[model samples]
Structure formats: C-alpha cells, structure tokens
Target chain A: MSFPITLTVNGSAREILLDDPRVTLLDLLRERLDLTGSKKGCDRGQCGACTVLVDGRRVNSCLALAVSLDGAEVVTIEGLASGGELHPVQAAFLAHDGFQCGFCTPGQIMSAVGLLREGHAGDDPERVREGMSGNLCRCGAYQGITEAVLAAQGATARREDAA
Target chain B: MNRFEYVRAGSVAEAVAAGAAPGAAYLAAGTNLLDLMKGGLATPATLVDVTRIPGLSAIESLPDGSTRIGALVRNSDLAHDPGFAARYPAVAEALLAGASAQLRNAATTAGNLMQRTRCPYFYDPASACNKREAGAGCAAIGGATRLHAVLGFSASCIAVHPSDLCVPLAALGAEVEIEGPAGSRTVSLTAFHRLPGDAPERDTVLEPGELIVAVRLPPEAAGFAAHARYLKVRERTSYAFALVSAAAMLRLDGGRIAEARLALGGLALKPWRAEAAERLLAGRAPDAAAFREAAEAALEGARPSGEATAFKIELARRIAVRALERALAGTPERVPALPASPFSAPLANPLPSSGAIAHA
Candidate 1:
C-alpha cells in the first residue's frame, strides 16, 4: 500500500507518495529523489556506505524506512556545499586524497560532518579513527581519510573560534 | 523489506492493541529488524512504528536515584548522557563498543535487546536452523562454532546473542518494563532473555504484542560506579563482535570487596551472569589470585558446545580476569578512546566531578 510521506531532503521540502513501505531511506534518496550521492554497499547495516544525517544524527540510511521518517530533516552529501564553495570536509578530502575509487567518499564526508557536529572526537587522531570506523574504504585510503578528518576538524574549530 | 502495513503508533495503549494482531511486529529503529527482513529471516505482515510515541524516548532520572531509560532512547544518547555515563560507565562503554557510531545513533535500547542471534547458519536461509524454522534441525550444532556459546548452551541451539550493552545491563541487575494489551509488568534483565531450550525460536520471554516500554537501573546499581569496567576481546582492533566479552563491577571496602557483579557476553543466548563468582569475590582482597578463582567460578559449568569452540572457554576466563582487574583499577575519568577494546589504554585525565559521581 502506498503511503503519503513528506521529508526535507538537502534543504528542500519533498512531498512524495511512498508506494511501498519497504523502500528504505537510502533507496528513496537514490531512486525517487534522483539524489544518488548516497552509495549502497552491503545494503545491510554493516557497511556505512549509505550514511546520512537524519535530524542531525549520522545513521545508516540503508536500515531506516522512509515511510517511518516522514517529516524528518535529512542532509546528504549533495547538501554539504553551498554557492560553489566546497564544504571544509570536502576540501580536506581533496587536499588529502581521501579516496581511490571514490565510492565511499560521499558517505565518509557525510559521516565526518555528523561526527564533527557530535564534537566528541575533537582532533585526537585515535578518537577520529574510532569515530570514522563505520565507513570502510577497501582501497586502503584510511590513512588519508584520518588526515582529512583531522584537518577538517581543525579548520571547523578555527572557523568557530573566529565567529 | 517485504511490503507491510506501516503503522505509526499514536499512543502506548494504541500501540499495544495494534501490535496484538497476528503477524505484527513492533518496529523501533529497524536496525536489526530490517536486516532480518532483507535476509528473509523475519516476515511480519504489519510493523507497529513506535518511534513517534512521545514519552518512550525520555531518559528519566527518578527521585529515588534509579534511572528509567525509555525503550526508544538511542544507544549513543544513553552512552553520551553525562549523568547516565557517570553513574554507569561500564554500560556506556559497552554501548559505545557495539556496532558503529551510525548504528548506535539509530539503534534503540529495546531494539538492541530484541536483536536475534548472529549465527551464520541462522542467517543462511539454506542452512537448517531450528531457531529460524522450528524442528528444521540445528545446523550450527556442528557448523563453524568458533563464536558459539560455551556456557548455558543447549544442544537444541548453540547460537549466542550479539550485544555489548546487555552485558553491563545484566551486571547492573536491571529490570525491563513491559506493556501489553492486558496491562504493564516488569521482568529482570536476566530473565528477559531465555536460553535456547527445546524452543530455539523464542528468543525472549515477552508475550506476543507485549512491547518493552523502558529499562530500569536500580539506585544501588550506581553504587559500583567507581569500580566498573567492560572488557571486550575481538578479532579486529575495532568495530568487531566480541569473541568473549566481560562486564565486571565491584563495591570495595578499602582493600577488600564488599560486593561484586560479573556478567559475560557473546558466550550464551543471554548475558550470562556469574553469581558464584560474585559470591566468591565478596570479602576477599581484589588481587590476581582472587580474580583467577572468581573467573574459574564464573566458568564452572561451562562446556564447549562443539570442539571448535573449546578455546572460547579459556578466552572467557582470561577476559573475566582482565575485566575484574580493570574494575579494581577503577573506571576511567572518561570512556576509553576505543571503548571496550583491550588495546584501549585508560585515559589519565581526571573526570569532571559533575559527570563522574553518581547520586546513588
């Protein structure tokens, strides 16, 4: 049975007729909304390829049902930047070469943004590593990913201090 | 991920009534349920979405110093709560140890308790699993048993419950509040999960449509705040299931133990509490020799379900010792960077007095 659901994705109001309750938030973002930045790896909750921000929390979108998340605010990789300026996390990824195949980069950046909002990891390399353990890059780009997160966190903190 | 009627429960009473229908299951975060559905392990006709329930998401500190964690409270929320973490550091550590930050952010307390076994045989629909299909025969009985249970394991099923939070909850002697169509009742955390006896399919003691409303930690449970630690041993450096984890909490009177609480995880269908070990530790000095004896008592009835899993018994015993030793050393000012991993060195920073002391 189809359910009428509305969600704010990437800062835009999206009122949709969810024809199938089985459609996950990940699928809704990719298939229906045509926002394919969220990658699907291992459709199960194990892989963090489908990570996104739901109400300011980083969650595995692959496991979240779109119908149940009606009225929730979602932020995906596509929403990370504004006005031709790259998000600090995105810029850091570019600076550090955080991806080889780039399949897991979007999820990693979104998760890193969520992690920065959480503010528990700070700039500690160990905490950053543990915080980002969810998004796995089989390309063995973890060293670069860690450096990017550390750099982005430093940049964000400096911006906050200036503000 | 089958097509099912999605119901947003308006109230607790309405949720109970709607959930009582046949072929209906309560959906909280759907972290585990959706995974099972995709694997064809669980097929429910109706999903009672309980997330929108107003009061179920609260984390209340009762007047009596006991804490009531709403069933919908997310794992990361509970772990990151300064008061909750200060009072129950081991629980916070255990919570942070499980899954990734994303899963913990989305997964709820009740959902974590309701998750099924992680047995590969059970996940494989082709494999005969009594837990999946009653009377289908147990394939895990003779299959890859390295991660199987050692204690409290029945020949009927050898699968173990994969939860790090439940270990500390079991140690704290927490109680689970349940609401059904009839009324409300509470069950101890230890009694909430049933051993896989002849009926391997029934993982929990909850009657159908009886939803877990909240989990309560008694005021006295916070009494062990200074000396509580959860130690987990995993195959990887991080983000891996425990091979054999332990939660150890002690109430010390000077150099001697006044009381003790110990529970082992990833070892049995339920978090295996070690009452005998607790009894042995009381009035004794907290030492390696004492801990060794207590660890031995904890695994007294343990026997490998299969030959391949015999190493788990020794691993459980060793982890038990390390857990007790760490508990005596004292809970860290903050949760370790790597959480329950053995490799995580306890941070030396002094804990903020506000978040370290328990009211109880």
Candidate 2:
C-alpha cells in the first residue's frame, strides 16, 4: 500500500511518498516539508491555528489528510510573502497591530487572506468580524484583526489578491 | 490519532464496494471525521477517500424544477449559490449561521447531514454515554441537562442534534439519495435520522456501506422562499451552537395562512418538524394570536427532561413564535450581518426575548 502524491505548494511542485497514511496536511507541512510557520494550537479543527489555503480555499490543515490531496495546490503562511516585500495583508497586520503575542499571527493572516479572496466582507467591520470569527485571538486582539481585514481588503482588491 | 489505511475511491461504485467493508469509513473533507478521531470517539480501520470522486460536487437544477445538491459540495458554496439561496433562503441562512467560515469551507453537505451530536458526554470518552458505548449509562441524564433535548428524547439519550442546516432542510421536505453496495435508494431527510429510543448508537438508518450521493429538494420547497427564516438562539452572538432554533416558513393567501412548515433544532434528537402546529395554522391568519396557538401546538407534548431545561420549554415556545413572526414579515432582501441570530436581524415585532433562563 504505497501512497505517492504530488502537490503544488507555493507554486512549487513537490512529489512525496508517504510512509503513514494517517499523516495530515498539518503534519506533512511541518514535519516533511519544513513549513513550520503554521502553528499547531489544538491539532484539531476547533482552533484556527492550523488554517491554510487548499486549492484557493481556506481550510483547517489538521483536519485534511495528506493522501486525500494528491493533486491539490496548498499555500501556507511561509508562502505568503514574495522576495522581501510583505503581502498586503501582512503589511496591513503590521500597520494595524493585529497581533499581541504573535502566536496566532500566521493562521490569522492566512484566514484574513482567504476572507479577502472570498470577497464577502466589504469595508463593513461587522461583516469582517463575522467572517473572521473562525480565527480566535486569545489575546483579545479582535478589534485590530477586524480593522486589519477591513483595511487589507481595500488594498488587496486593487491588486486582485496578489498573495 | 490512530493510524489507519486510506483508499481514494475513484468512483461511487468503488466507494460503495470498499465503504461496505467492516471498519471502513468514507472521508470527504475530513472536517468532522478527523475531529472525532482526534477525540478518540471514532476509530475506523480504513478511510475511503471520497473527496475526489467524480461528479459528486455539482449543484444541478433538475428538469422537474427541483434542486439537487451533491453530497461533496462544500457548505460555503451551497449557501453562497445565487440560484439556490434565492429559492431556499432559510437553508442558506441556516448554513451561514453554522460553524466558522473555515469549517464551512471544508465541510460538505453529506458530512453536515451525518454530523454527530455535540453532547459533552459523547465527546468525553471517559464519561458513560449510550451514544458512544452501547448499553453504557447516560452521563448527561442528570449532568449538564441544559442543552439536552426537550422533545423526542428517551432515557437512553438526551443528546440533541447539533445541526443548524438540518432544521431548514427538514422543514423544506428535502430527500436524501443513497447508494449502497446493493443498489440506490432515497428517503426523506426527516426520516433519515433515527431518534434515540432503545438504541442511541445508531444515529441514522443507513446500512453499514450506504453512501449519501446527493440531497434533492422538492419543487414545492421553493414555495416558502418568500416567507421563510431560520432563527438560531445561541449562547453567544456569533459562531456558537443554538440553545434552541426554529425554521419557520409560511405561504399566505389573501392575508390568510395557506400552509405553514415549522421545524426546530437544539430541541430534539432530530430536527423536530411541527406538522401538528402547521395543521393548527393552516386557515388562520398570520397574526400574533395564531402564531401563539401554533407555537403552543408545536410544544404540545414537550416536557423538560430535567431541571436545567425547564425554562427552555418556555424559551422554545417563544422561539417558535419569534421565528414564525419573522417569516411572516417576509424574507430579508439580504442575509443580515449575522446569519440566524434574532438580535442580528431587526424584527418587525421582536418577541421580547425569552432568552437565557437561569437554572439553579
């Protein structure tokens, strides 16, 4: 029972052979691919610490099995920036002070990026708050997070989700 | 999580063949199954990956004017579908009201339908739960009876179905299409889920290898689109399970009630469809008094399972009244800033919240 899969991570193709079928996308990204930017807060789907974009949609990486996404495209926190310039969302997070302890920064940023791509929340702070409700900030930084998302949407909509 | 074999079924036939085997489960987006595995509650030996199964992700409009939603279609996609939301507003509202955005993006239609109860005892393996272990004592019987069922609960289980989408679907008379190792069949969504009677472990009537292929809405379901709403009463303002919810849809003719469909969540082992209430409100006017009578009829046989939910009986009746009133007010032009919360959508005449009754 050999499991060989190919996935495009951050526009780079990777061919990997799995020794264990139980490996989740979270485990694969961190342990096998050396992408540790995505944190493992709960190792379950409850917390958004393991959030990542799979095939252009945000999902809980911990809940996704590696073998199930054989030909999928994945984007994690490590792949958000290009060269040295920060993505609009990361820059907005910095400008808006969206993080206090910065533990949930990566997952929060990824979720915000997904939210912008979905384009459900415009400049409305209320919609932004409800859209980002999945990512919990234990440090009570929701106001700034919502602000960052609202600001980032305007900036990213011009660039058409460049990240 | 325990180690298990993974098989990506290429087609429905392959999925049915492998999924029919003992100790094998179907894996779609892995939102619920993986969570259950992490909690040590589910331990399937093999997972038949069905995410990539061909033709299981399309939302098609049938020639019969009914809508067919594929089992693998993501929850977010179904809610955001322009044609679907226009026809079934309450279902969309219920979907948007449930789970966080990320979970909805990964969760699928069938996965949502097959969701397990959120009862604390069911998740806590150390606690005795008849749903988790057959013949085991019910730990939630006397403990944490606040969110337990007020209707269709038995001594074996008091756990309520934790699905917001099911409430609207059941009210709209949706049907579930299933494919097993033997053949294909269909059953109404209302009868799909089994109540906890002598056997609490069996959540649904599916045989071991049956796979839910698609859920089809009847042509008549669209009739309630204009006067339908899903109102969820959660502990918090957003992203929380409902304490009590109601899906109220009405068809009015010349200021008189033509027909009414009411289903409730967080009140029973399944979405409690109130046909008796509908019968009471068939010819009556869509006024407060008629709504009150229908609400009372909806709760005709309801009794608190324990002291924790004693006030919830009154609250459930109030929610039924409130949801009916919202539906009669006409479906909102756009989904409110919040999906199903009563507070989010300003009502024409908000039933003074029968909210949060304190129990000592």
Give TM-score values for chain A, per-prediction: 0.98, 0.95
The two-chain DockQ for each candidate, comma-separated, is: 0.86, 0.84
What is model 1's interface RMSD? Answer: 0.9
Runs of candidate 2 with Cα error greater than 4 angstroms are A158-163, B349-360
Q: Write the per-residue lDDT of candidate 1 for residues A1-163, one digit (tens) a residue.
A: 6799999998999999988899999999999899999999989987799999999999999999999999999999999899899999999999999999999999999999999999999989999999999999989899999999999999999999999
Give the per-residue lDDT digits (tens) of candidate 2, residues B34-76.
Answer: 9999888999998999988899899999999899999999999
Q: Report the C-alpha lDDT of model 1 over B115-138, residue by residue, as the tens digit.
A: 999988999999999999999998
Which residue pairs show collisions in model 2?
none
Q: TM-score for all predictions?
A: 0.97, 0.97
Question: Number of clashes in every candidate structure?
Answer: 0, 0
Q: What local lDDT does model 1 show for residue A145?
A: 94
lDDT of 2 by residue, A82-130 (tens): 9999989999999999999998889999999999988888888988988
